[model samples]
Target: MGEMYTTHEEEKLIDIVLDSILSGVVIIDNKDHVIVDVNETAAKMIGLAKEDIIGNVCHKYICPAEIGQCPVFHPWQNIDRSECVLLNYKGESIPILKTVKKIKKDDHLYLIESFIDISKIKETKEELLVKEKAIDSSINAIALADLEGNLTYVNHSFLELWGYGDEKEVLGKPSVEFWQDESKAEEVKNALFFEGSWVGELLARKKDDTDFLVNLSANMASNEFGKPVCMMASFVDITDIKKANLLIKRKLEIEETVASISSMFISPKNIDQTINVALEKICELCGCSRSYIFRFSNDGTRMSNTHEYCPEGVSPQKGNLQDLPVEMFPWWMGKLHNGEAIHIKDVSSLTEEASAEKEILEMQGIRSLIVLPLYTNSELTGYLGLDNVLNTGEWEEEDINILSLASQITGAGLERRNAEDMLMNAKIAAEDANLAKTEFIANMNHELRTPLNSIIGFSDVLSSENFGTLNDTQKKYLSNVVVNGQHLLRIINDLLDLSKIEAGKMELFPEKFVILDAINGIKATMMPLAKKKDIDLKCNINIGNPLIVADALKFKQILYNLVSNAIKFTDQGGSVTIGVNTSNELISVFVEDTGLGIAQNDQGKLFNPFSQVDSSNSREYDGTGLGLALVKNYVEMHGGKVWVESEVGKGSKFTFTIPVENQITRA
Candidate 1:
């Protein structure tokens, strides 16, 4: 009985040890049967109660037909070792990594099977796969390099960044090949070792043989023992940033140059000097080697090189105005006529015909240029040309704008200089004319008064009948003598008045009077002369009684001269019409005549003092030819304009405008 108790105790001890094992365990008897003693974990794994499985056959219970069969059931019947799947009571198969062994004790066969659930292992594998896929899809370049500076792993982003086809092609290659400068590789290696990290810019080469800059961050990765394992690196491209910075620097330089050139205007003296200084500033700032300023003649076909500047020993001759080939510079000609700016970026890139002029420029080392047309009050005055002789590439848009602004400033300076020149010339001409008038007045006084004194003395004697009583024939002759003497005196007075007007010494005495009344008075005074020629004298006053501020006497004289001249030119049976029209701001008067009209060629000479339309016209008119001249001066003094529109045979119309009293009411 003690021996029996020892066996039970030993069996119980073995069961406790088996249940304590972390793996699931099951036992089977001979004939592939079960002496079921499953541990707690084994019972849970098969979904069976311990009592239910205790006496069941292993093949029927754990490896039922139509389910996965367990290899442990027939371990000795087969190879004596096996693994298999087990089925739960619900008939669901559970995959177990199983090992089966046979044991013999006292002629009873026994099977021991051990296994672990592989579902957890499969789950861990799937998690690792997902993490790898996430790393591959990232955009930033991620790479792992060994302590020896050899690449061990590269994600898709890293491969793409360096333009590598696959890991096989790039895994063992040195990371230094990506750096454009070979010396930077040693610097990077030292930084990684000493500081355990490095982050900065690098010039990297591309697959297409191009190079770019990248902002890169690299750090040394180490194991827990402080032993170096690998390195991790991330990079971002910064090529565009570098380029933008360079462009900004260039633009600032151009602005500084524009400011310097504009300062020349403060003391500009001559147009040529102003343009030369501006062009020199542009060439210096832009690194341009050649520049020229060309002045176009009044007829734009001609262009003369007014000023030119080049680097030492490279100057062009001052070209003749007509020698520049027109066909070679169609763009320049068009700009000269149309007042536009021309920008040529690359002369060599143009078509053959367009670039035909490039040979001369290229020989002088010019690659690009800009031509800007200069103007004076809408007239094509000249051109400003700036050329880049030493630059290898085309000029950028910013360069063109800078030079164009300088050209505009130069154009404005030229215009101001031209205006000053014209004003100076006008001043000198006025002084010369004043001196001549003073000498002419002195000569006229001495040459004409002696004859005038005798004529006037005789006329007074004859008119008073102071000499003697005379017969009818003698009296007629004496009347003729008095009439001739009075006409001579009138001629001398007219000459004196004209001289005063020419010297700008005439004074205007202005008064408000109805303009139509003045027109009518002049017509009445000239009617007798018109009647003597048997001509119709008429006054058409379209203007109502609008008052005008003018010298009434001078205004009357202006009208009388025009009307009398009309009557004198009219043949017998012809008509003289004097018309006046007034509006809100202006009064217009027209004197029309049917007469031997003045010739077109002689119209311009009619207003000059002491000048007539023709010698025959003077002979026929029998007076000093200063009437119209004085009439012009009188009209202009009242701020009016006078002009004549006449054809050789179609008669003449003299028109004049006077500002009315209401128009100048404020003044």
Candidate 2:
């Protein structure tokens, strides 16, 4: 290729011209496709020196054409100018704009190739593509508008947010069309134009004209010249968040009111006042004119407004609503009976089926009302209702929930009050019955005791032959009369003592006395009875103290009754023991008997007056059933407790305690 030059100086001149150009140049032999002369720019583009690249095949350095498949040499196709790649010394492909010119100089054909590096232009275009993709995939509704505020571009999220089918539907539309308030939209646009950005919540409308709240951020988009070209905005739907916040606030308020109502019921000052206060709270919270409770009659045939509250300027309806016939409110009462709440948004919306209910409600000046069934133990006893006499206001689910909770609390409180009332009445009736019984026993004491004593004394006199010597049959008959008469007299005395104790008329005469002496006396008196049954009687005085402070007569009576019961229940050849012990400043006395033991089930009734294990007419025991009862009463009067330990077929032990002298004397 150097030989084609006319002179060495001429070749030097051409090299100087090519090296000064910014673009790369290489002259290739058109016949052999081999490089001849290469400029400095082309050498640098291939990362090689001029001497190294001068003899390389043109395809190996700059052109990508394979050997003998030169695109430039083809007759059918022309590659004069094109965007292509240059292969560098490191085998990296560099993008370029290349031009090839076929020229004949000095009768030698050659291809002159020229190219310029375009890496920065390619990079800039790629960056723009990536940014476009990023904006299209964003989650926030993103839109771009022209300077005139007509939409030019919208992302997928924007389509879904505004309920548009596709970009075509919104691309040419004015941005203000999507906003519920056009004036506010204009204000937002003005803010963006003046302030360069605007961020706030605005009401946005969907394609179907349904409005929702959105947090919008708008910014003025500018060109490279720094002139504002369009408005760009991103939107985040905030409708659900707003609603949830409101619901949470509503729930907190309801909870506070419900807690107040529950506290009142827990420790009520008065039921009527509590109900009235609770009604007032419900009415105020519900933003209603009145709140009331309607109760169903026990027979289920009548209803009454038992409790009600009305704010000032409202009429009180409770006085006129008493004893209303249930048949008149068939629909309303049916719902209440089925435990269903009746939430009437507007009384006028009532159909023909509820005409009666509507009439009744409107008569009381109620436009909207919510009546919840009051349940006690799963039975619907009444309804708690709120009336919106001021207007026909809509009721929300939160309101219904509040009313339902209030109804439950009200129902429970009312049920408790009813039970308390019943208990009071029963208590009064029991007191009256006890008084009558005491009076009857008092009358019987005077009427029956004297005759029984006279009968017993006459029989004793006759048996002792005070009048004359009697036959054996006559003597036996007199003995029988004396025994039966004495038993009847004992029963009468026991009855009088029991009545006195039960009526709380009995008094104690506490005195210090030798407890051992009382025990010995009891053993001596009970010995004859024990001997009759062929049973041995014994006394066990195991105590440090021999004295006790108690009612003297009652103490002796307690000992006598226990010892007598031991002797009476002991079988033939069985033994009875009166044991005494002192501990903890108290004396414990136990009367143990080898007797027919009481059944476990019957021991609980032993101390109840007139309660016998075997009370039938033909039972074996002959007790008047008052002796043990009297013992228990007398023991307890001294602030002591009595109990019996017995198993069937295992004998019986009756134990009681009385305070010792040191303890009792201090009292």
Candidate 3:
């Protein structure tokens, strides 16, 4: 135990060797736990010089052991090594892994203690535990397996996800056995080996042998030599997600079918084609073998497959069924008559109520069928039928509801077809009537104008005294006859012209002429009548472009009709003016009369043939009620428009505009 036994130089040599090592070392007597020898590493570790610690008790510096409780001094206690702290000069704690063991050297037993800093190791160990806990609590299934596919480790979620009660059930077993598809497992293994990872969806098997869809990702784990030794995998169950996607796809198909059928009914050019397309879409969407629309007869005693569709190599009922008698299927007829649709899943399982109908259906190779009643105006009109000859199918409520909508669309289409037919027939009848009226007017104009002109000619001849000298009374009477005949001829001509316009046979011979000249001619002829009525007649022409290209004769007739009507409506001393506002763009003519204005309600009737403004005024004014109608037609034929503005007792202004584009008409 005496340190002076060794030379100073030898002790220094031993100290250098001890301090050169990374771990602190010290020696003590096993009997008393006394420090007999210490190395430079130990001196630096405990903050002491060799001389001070050479004889001190070991427990005072590094060991917090009780009397004779040192692990090395009392090896029989079985405490070989333990963690402890050492006090430095600054009274700070130094962490050390202190181990003591009895060693016999030079026939004397001593305890050698060894330790090093381990703070980083403790921190890293805690962090690793935290990560393990995180992996175990994850929602995703996580597992590790050996290269040979033996399950090495699994998390709690992995156990719960694969229908396993405990990890012991799957550990060390082939992971491929957990896959529903073995080929997919091979694929995953190959991907992990070649690409360092594998990611995809695959069908996986549970412990109960039930299959589920899973989104799986697996990565390779390697040893220190960089050789792949195991695999780490994470999975999420997606079985329900796959089912929902299928449902969404089916819903889209049904919606597309409904849209196509609705479009067909809205614009049905060919009824057969529309019905066929509708049937094809419905059949395709519902996975039916055939489809048809059976319309009920008027008496409800029979029905017929008016429209039918079938796949290739299938028999068509349209060619064979003609007015199928309702008595043939008694039970079916009763249901249809009550407005109830019929759906049969299996003809072989029909009850007593469907025996007769099922017998007929099976005779035609029908296994399953569905019928939806079609209605129009709250009355059952027909039915939409679907047949599945190959497979006995059960129709879902959602599918039945879609077919019902198809039935309604069929009803609307048929109803619209009937309406269109009626409209066409009515249109044809009206055209025939209009043609007859036009011909009648043409013949009457010829027949009435001949004798009327002869009467006028004779009256004028007699009044002229060409045949003989006449008395004053005879002269006055002849003048009256001529004036009345002229009036009647004018009325006949207006009727003929209006008929021509309405019949679309009226023609205009356009010519360039000063409209004022035509107005002058009319005014000269009408002034005598206006003077007789004590009314003033004037023509105001603002002829900026007097070289107007129009039907000059018709234009004069239009102005004459308006002016004459005004003069007739005006009282004595009232004024009648025919004027125009001309421009490069258009020529507008106004016939304004200071006289009794037409009523607001009666103005609508003013331009209708044979429609007078007022019954009371009709008795006072001489008119056939065709003047304004002819005026409107004539003005319109020249690409012009006419409108009237007036107030009660404030007179009226009838204005008409002729676009300059119409001036393109040449003589």
Candidate 4:
């Protein structure tokens, strides 16, 4: 009995171990209807206890319907095979994995069934559905392709982005069909096979056959064995980004052009060069066809073309300010004269008068232009005109500002050039004046020395008694020769002194002396000439003798020249008078002569070198015309003024005044 208990115990243990296995197991009796044995897994799968399943028919516990309605219960009924379904339990169908087969034990028919719980697989499929829904709702287009480059799946975004309705229309198609350029297909395939991923831009065709650019990132998916199974690609539309990038690039180019132009003015060498460079730079920067610089005449009657830049065969019409035909340019001149810049974006939209100007410009292929006025010291000087920008777009405020600055620089350069020209002209004039004075000195030396040489030679022969023993008449003629020779020598000396004064080389020899002494010295020297002409040369002193500091030699030379000219120009019987007067700080000398008075028209030329009243008067005077001119210069050197009061037929009075100094005067 113990041995029998041991066998039963071993069987019970084996049954418990079998019941613990994962697969559902059951056994049926030979009748093939009732369950004789069932493991725990099988009993739980049918929602029944092991004892209940052991006695019940397997069809009642495990079939999809009740035992009376089950088709598997009748063996000859030709039931096809086992199928999976939820078993009926407690009036509800519980899902189970079922399999049924016939087992023959000792020549009796028995049934064995096996199954597995497959509910997790159904839950996993539901989860996969959720993931697909999520991908379809994304904004970015998502696509899936098989390893062979065939389209396998595509979300709604992918279909809509490519202008397709559903995945069915796209699934079997090769991904290369969406690429606008067929050559890119090989590159895409290589990227997927070698690198396993590619991210770049590409042109894609839509359903309407129009192409657009897209930024695409494609990645390959592979199984654990490293064989590529599929590929996923995500793309974003980049057409707008591409357009914006183009615009930014153009703007940067414009800025670079403007910067280059601005650097040209850092240190300009000259006005014309600066203007020319500016014109070229502006044309290049704005993409213009022509440029010109116009300068107006001072009288505002004409405009001169200073510079022009254009294509080889193009030429601008020359215009005059006054005759610009109000019908052609009504406001242009007005604005330019007012120092205003004018900008015309579209010439066609201008007024009638402006339109006429525009028509002329358009004939030259100019559609847009900017005119900047050049001003200096608040006066309009010229204009800087740019024409025919290729784009015909409106100029910005910054462009206008840059042009305004260029105009200012141009105005400054022109002003500097004009001033330099004026200085150069002044230097030329000064050089010419010096040359004229040099010629005058040479001519005067030859004229004065020739007559003086003859007089001295004749006088020396007579004095030495070389001619013969002199009679009374001979002695008188010799005396006359000596007197005239001395007079000629004095005139030559005066001429030399006057030349020195004019050339800024004369020096003054100053000393203290009485004014009466100077007058008496002059009267004593001129008495002989006056007596020969029977002219009364007198000295009148109006002030008490006053001592003053002055150059005695220059003073006496001045008095001698004045007195001698008076006596020489007076007629034989005319009287000559010398008067001296003194006041608070000046001494005045007056020499009056009854002579041929100067004409009013000849007064202005009186002080010029070698000039007489006129050429006719030069022949009548036996005196050098330089005496009076010398006197005037010497008097001015002493800080005095010499002038004449005369009428055509009346006598003349030459008056001169010198400043008096109480201290010692230097030589």
Query: What does candidate 2's lDDT look like per residue over 1-667, in tens digits?
Result: 4346888899899999999999999888877777898899989999999999877777787757644435556733455557778899998999888877778887878888888998998999999999889888988899999888899999999999999888999999989999999999999988888999999999999999999999999999888998999999999999999999988988888889999999999868699899999999998898888899988888878889999999999999999999999899889888887778898888988999999988888898899998898886667778899898878868888778889999989888987888888999999999999888888887887788887888888888888897899999999899889888888888888898888787777888888888777777777877788888899898888888676788788888998998888887888999988888898678888989988999989999999888899999899878878998999888878888899999888799999987775333211
Model 3 C-alpha RMSD to native: 5.2
Off by more than 4 A, model 4? 1-127, 146-150, 164-174, 185-187, 190-195, 255-285, 290-328, 331-667
Clashes of 2: 0
TM-score of 4: 0.42
Best candidate, lDDT: 2
lDDT of 1 by residue, 56-149 (tens): 7776545343323444433424332234557778878766666667776665667776766666766788998997787788787887877777
Predicted structure 2: lDDT: 0.86
Worst 10 contiguous positions by lDDT, candidate 3: 658-667
Q: Give per-model TM-scores.
A: 0.49, 0.64, 0.82, 0.42
Q: Which residue pairs come into collision in candidate 3?
A: none
Which regions of candidate 3 fall more than 4 Å away from where they truly are? 1-127, 327-330, 351-355, 472-477, 538-547, 599-611, 615-625, 661-667
Model 3, range 1-667, lDDT digits (tens) per residue? Answer: 5332357888678677877878878877876768887877778877889888878777777757656656754567544446677766666777677777776756677777877766677788899999999998999999999887789999999999899998999999988999988987988887888999988999999888999999998999988999998899999998889899999988888887898889889978997789889998888888788899888899888888888889886788686677988788878877877888798998889998878777777777889989988886668877889999998868878768888898888888888888888998999999898878877877887788998999999899888897789999999999999989998999998888888777677888887788778878999999999999898898888777777888888888998899988998899899999888888878999999999998899888888999887667448676889999998888887878999998889999999988754643321
Compare candidates 2 and 4 on TM-score and give the better one: 2
Q: Pick the candidate with the highest TM-score.
A: 3
What's the CA RMSD for each of the models? 12.8, 7.5, 5.2, 21.3
